[model samples]
Target: MRAAGAQRGRVKRARLADVDPSLIRPALAGLVPYEPGKPVEEVQRELGLERVVKLASNEGPYGPFPAALEAIERATLELNRYPDGGAYRLGQALAERYGVRFEEITVCAGADAIIGYLSLATLGPGDEAVTGWPSFPSYVLDPLKVGGTPVRVPLERGRFDLEAILAAVTPRTKLVFIAAPNNPTGTTNTRAELDAYFAAVPPHVLTVLDQAYFEYVDDPDYPDGIAEYAKAGRRVLVLRTFSKIFGLAGLRVGYGVGSEEVVTAIAKVRRAFDVASVGQEAALASLGDHGEIERRRIANREAMALLTQTIRGAGLDFAGPAVGNFLFVEVGDDAETMHGALLRKGVVVRPLGPFGAPDALRITAGTPEEIDFLSKTLSDVVPAFR
Candidate 1:
């Protein structure tokens, strides 16, 4: 048996060695892979539980809008045909909505793809991409994929330190990613703060504003991203997603709005048929259903409020002033322990260790019952960790 196991191991190693070494980028080899949230069925099977509340990923509490569903169903018959590679109709809709020219918009499989494409298009070996630490990992990994350096400025008091970000910029800085209402922490930069930061940044550097959770933001202080910067013709690419608010996470549709030149450059690196026909149709239909989207927004706000109250009542410290669909709770020292404990109970929340936030877990605002389950789970597990 020992001899047979040794031979099998040797064969595996030999097979791996036969693969092209150059195919795997050196930087990627050292990097840890992105850990996705546990799928509902997988968690259910693992825990042997009937109900599993997943408050990870910050997906919409409400599922896809009715209009989007109808559009998707209508487009399903046309699956045999290729998608509009240019995404012309979606681009036109987005352009009209944002008051930008059709040439200034670029749609992709998701915002994540757009980030990768942008990094590949604009960054090189010697270039640097500056962003806040504990922001989205894609902001750093995308840049590093193309041999670019990532300079991460740590957040100040759970918020992005605009001044520190400005100070970190140098001649080699090619790109800057500003995740307003940043992921993990769910804190946002105000319009005034952004204006000041933009003033400090040199014209040569491009800023990618990731507004995946923009629709959920109710703060008057939160910057109206496209209008505040992109419309002014600054070196900014504003990214929006149907994945979050539109409940199209399964569809993988997101868009970037920027200057015609910037959009054109990014488009050069994008793959053919980047977004599917169904996704385009769904997103386009979603655009027309303003009332339904608003209803979801209202529901999310109520859920957030309930969660916030529950967290505070439990004496847990959480990051607030969040303009997004999720909240970040500082679960003292044993965040990982709590995460595991909750997972076993069939309550999946995102641990923030990847985003450099070791003591926090990002919880998406779910339905009332789901929030109740999370609250009960935390109340039970948190004290044991303490």
Candidate 2:
């Protein structure tokens, strides 16, 4: 009987190698998994260091709003109960806050979840989702995961080539994602540019404007997609999150405002209790904390300026405007080498090689001391650039 069991195990081991790879969906087969920012705890654990400054992810260093913290505390008692599947109260709050119809609003786990919903709601096999390259990784990955073609238009000098994006549209194109103040690049389109792009977009296609870092932006030229969506009466979705300026990254709450019909379609496939009770309460609390948002915004601007100036002083050119709480600076050395050197110095930053900027690094705008440490660390590690 033991020999027979051993023989069965051997047969299964041999069959594992012979198993058909086609069992997995072909679209997702070649898809590269998204690489998230390095966690602070991970660096500390790996390097056996107690002080690790993680400026890899563009998370705010000031922490979440006090009210949001209190809300989370208040919500702990309700953990046993499942959250409202419909998210009725939070949905209503968002609608009133954004001046959109209550039916036009939908809350989800985050912008990433909403992106996935958009992919499934709009895309099918052979259909395409158009977006700018090096903008947001999920903009491409989400559609590809759902067996849809991703049409990537290369950026124009670290900015979206709106004309090229429009030209890339085809009969199979069901959606287009515009990451305003685009990720990794930090460049944004002006009001005029957005107006022209929206005017020319075909009515058949849905344009999703991802404004995850909207509050961080202070540029007068930047166009507000929410206002555009409200006035244009087009098939548009504006995605915003409490993650960035609100310092609610851990809560994972975000919302989308769109045409009621489109919101309904996306809501159909939304997972039950997608946003947690704690998350919903925290985000709702965050919306009312304008003072915290403004304070963080001001702090971020100061930190971003300091980082950008330091990079420029080092004779490294940033790819675009440092509109977000991060700067994409040309390392002037190998990205991996600088990344490793900085990692050794307990400075965790993100390499832009995965974001198609092989020569650049994305450093988040952290606290003043952290920024000073990074500035000094860069000078020591990449002296040639300095």
Candidate 3:
């Protein structure tokens, strides 16, 4: 029996090796995989350090709210059953909050998943998706995955150049991804800018407004994607997630509010039971806790201010009035070296080589003690880099 098993394995290996490379999708050519931040466990294991603080992924330092914790506990009892494939309850909650109909809400595992679904549903060969570069990697990647071209407009002054983005739109452009409070840079597009974009953009394009860090923004001029576009009857899909301020990154729940037609199309392409039962419950609970959201928002603002102050104190420069949970610090040409030094010091921040800025790093807000440790560590290591 063992000999037969070995023979079958050998045959399988041979067949796999003999398979034609041409069978692979041509769209995948020259595409690099997305590089996420290093996990806490991996960092600890590699460095043999008992303590490590990760501010790499832009996740909140806090865990899920108390109500969300209870929701998770309750959800565990029904583990034997499958999750709601449509994520109906969570979708309903989001719909109510956004003042959109339930049919207009499309729930998915995360904002990334929604991007994938939108790409799959709307893009194909010879199609194009326009977006700002260094915003979200997924905007560039998802379109390529669906055999569509990506048109990248470079950011002007660390923020999306709305005029440049509009100029880039062609007749073939089916989607335009606008990352509000863009990742890495954390700068936002103003209401005036978005209003002009909506008015001028071609009718063929479906605009995707990604507002994953919307809750953290205090600027009164920062436009709410839903109120501005989706509710106001424009061809827009607004993407948001519980993964940011809500402290439910592990649960992987996010939602989109769009027209019923667009949401229906996305539903056709997205995976079944994309968001798990526990995630749905937790996200629903998290959505209802406005006070907790405000608390986290204020705390994040304070931490980011401290981080910025420390960076300036070190005689370093960063981009923003960053409205998100992180700062994009310019670490000089020695960013790689500085990153390694911080890693050795048991602080994990995101290196921006993949985001096309090799001279920078993204540091997120952490708890007070973590911030203190990071501040001291930065003070110790930054002078050498500069």
lDDT of 2 by residue, 1-386 (tens): 35444542343234435567778888888888988877888778777777889998888897778998899999999999999887888999988887888899989998889999989988898999999988778888889899999898999988899999999999899999998888888888888988898889998899999889999988888777887665468678999998889888887888898988888988899998899999988888888878878888899889988888877766677877668888887764577888898898899988976676777788888999998888888788877434
Go through the candidates in order and give the clash count of each.
Answer: 0, 0, 0
Clashes in predicted model 3: 0
Top of the candidates by lDDT: 3
What TM-score does structure 1 among the candidates reach?
0.94
lDDT tens per residue, model 1, 1-386: 35544542343224433667898878777687788998988888767889899999999977788988899999999999999999999999999998989999999999999999999999989799999988899998888889999999999988889899989999999899999889988898888999998777899899999998888888888887799898876789999999998999999999999888878888899998999999999999999788987888898889989988878877788887777888898986788888899999888999988888888888898999999998888788877765
- Give the alpha carbon lDDT tens digit for every residue of 1-386 in model 3: 35544542353224434667899898897899999999998889888888899989999899999999999999999999999999988888888888889999999999999999999999999899999978788898899998999998999999999999999998899999999989888888899999999999988889999999999999999998998788888999999999989999999998899989899999998888788999999999888788999999999989988888877887888898799989898876888899899999999999988787788988888887888888888888987865
Who is ahead in lDDT, 1 or 3?
3
Candidate 2 colliding pairs: none
TM-score of each: 0.94, 0.92, 0.94
Clashes of 2: 0
Structure candidate 3, residue pairs in collision: none
